[model samples]
Target: MTTERKAARLPVFDRAAATPEQEAVLDEILSGPRGNLAGPFLAWIASPELAEHAQRLGAFCRYSTGLPLRLSELAILITAVQWRAQAEWQIHYPIAIDAGVSADVAQALLEGRRPVFVDTDEALIYDFAVELYGAKRVSDMTFAKAEERFGHETTVNLVGLLGYYALVAMTLNVFAMRANEDEPLPFNE
Candidate 1:
């Protein structure tokens, strides 16, 4: 048997050829906060069922999470950097900064450096996300601090948010989907 390489397939969503299921999912995505069909949705629509579920989860993680948007965006940025998902990074970086994540911290992450966080909450979030990615589990100390600060429901939401964004990152990377090809890449050379 010949070896088959898994070449990168860029997301190319064509509206006219969409199946009924894809059309339904596309409608949901379009009517939501994201008014356009770009990013992971283009890749995800291939499996309309997965697209439907993931989009719901994404909406909850992005919009209804108990953690503030600032913290949620920070976690998303961390996930983006961890996955080296250029599209994810490019999309969320501005949102993170606008939601109160410091420019210095964002820059440091882009450069793959440990940032000196100014806010205690930002530090805690960074530590939590970093430890989770590094060790594949959060240390007890890290978990306790997160629990004490945010409580059970919100902490779960944080984890869920991390998970949802991770899915997004993977989809983006695998499909070679980019938010804007004209824009500079977020990672260092």
Candidate 2:
């Protein structure tokens, strides 16, 4: 029974079988600028029960534009780190860089260090990410401040972004997704 429990604790990716749809999703994601995609991401999308909804959620959370794209990416990056999701962090760190996030800041967040060049806005968002992910609740002060600084639409978008990547982080970690060798991690792989 102990051995069975131990085996159950292992990641699902070890037993994942790639279907045609899974390969297609992986191909699409890898075809993006990053040029490398993790297998677990594709596996999640390939599961018919989760695929369509995952696609919608991914698009709405990441690609939908309104709030500063950079900040949204940064928030997601920070959430990935707080979750200790190496695969999710690896996937988004480059996207954050492409969106104008600095390599130093990315490294700092990944290494459990406070970011140096964080602006007031970025810092507020980071605080929100930490609080939300760590405690699963946002303080009233944080909500008020975010509302005042970013306005309601952006605030809503921020929440959605957080929810989106949090789900991704869980899936990636549970699957133990491997980072593609073709695309190295930011700030030293």
* Global lDDT of each candidate: 0.85, 0.70
Q: Clashing residue pairs in candidate 2, if any?
A: none
Q: Which ten residues in a row have the lowest lDDT in candidate 2?
A: 1-10
TM-score of every model versus the real structure: 0.92, 0.74
Best prediction by lDDT: 1
Clashing pairs in 1: none
* Tens digit per residue, CA lDDT, model 1, 1-189: 111222258434567778999989988998998766656887787899999998989999999889889999999999999999988998898899999999999989888898998788888888988888899899999999999999989988888998899899998888776777789878653
After superposing candidate 2, which stretches have Cα over 4 Å from the reference?
Answer: 1-40, 181-189
For all predictions, the C-alpha RMSD in Å is: 5.2, 6.7
- Candidate 2 on 130-154: residue-level lDDT in tens? 8888889999999999999988887
